[model samples]
Target: MSEERETPERRRERLRQEELKRNPAGSIHGGGLPDLVGGMGWKFTGILILLLIVGFLIYSLFFR
Candidate 1:
């Protein structure tokens, strides 16, 4: 067989080159704020709400 076998390093380099080709130089990483919000979505909202509730409870218990 005349085909050359790809080694691990070669495979990694190939993948990186392919990624670079797909993503242009001007393109930014991730989806920025909207992407983060969408990815976190309900989970982040629920956590923040829960934290606020717990903090209020703690404050009320100690200061009221």
Candidate 2:
């Protein structure tokens, strides 16, 4: 009997496929975070980041 080790790319592809089968919505192409922020445009992302920073500052100053 002969055993063949899978390549890195093949292993990643297999893992992605299995994840897709188990959780269709959670599987990400190319094995990274989804491009939701990229698709949202720079202006929107900047605004979101600014809001998060402001919110954190406010919470730290007033709530904590």
Candidate 3:
């Protein structure tokens, strides 16, 4: 490596480029569904919904 140190702007640019390389052009974040899938994925979401539905049904049957 060269003895010359990188400036803040240059280091920031290099990190930005690396981040772009890691993510695709259409990568999105922070919406409800996007956050859901990003964290636990669609399969987990489906399972969770299924359990909630089953729990609700059992609660209604016995308590209501």
Winner by TM-score: 2
Mind giving the per-residue lDDT tens digits that candidate 3 earns over 1-64? 3426886545655665577678746345424554455456568889998999999999999997
TM-score of each: 0.38, 0.47, 0.43
Candidate 2 residues 1-64, lDDT tens each?
1125775545655666787799976644543533456346569888998999999999999987
> How far is 36's C-alpha from truth in model 3 (Å)?
4.9
Q: How far in Å is the alpha carbon of 8 misplaced in model 2?
A: 28
lDDT of 1 at 41: 50
The TM-score obtained by model 2 is 0.47
Location of the lowest summed lDDT over 10 successive residues in candidate 3: 26-35
- Which segments of model 3 are wrong by more than 4 Å? 1-37
Q: Going through the candidates in order, what is the number of backbone clashes in each? A: 0, 0, 0
Candidate 1 structure quality by residue, lDDT tens digits, 1-64: 2226775545655666677678767235744554344445577778977998999999999998
What are the lDDT figures for the candidates, one per model?
A: 0.65, 0.67, 0.66
TM value for model 1: 0.38
Model 1: residues >4 Å from true position, as ranges? 1-40
Global local distance difference test of model 1: 0.65
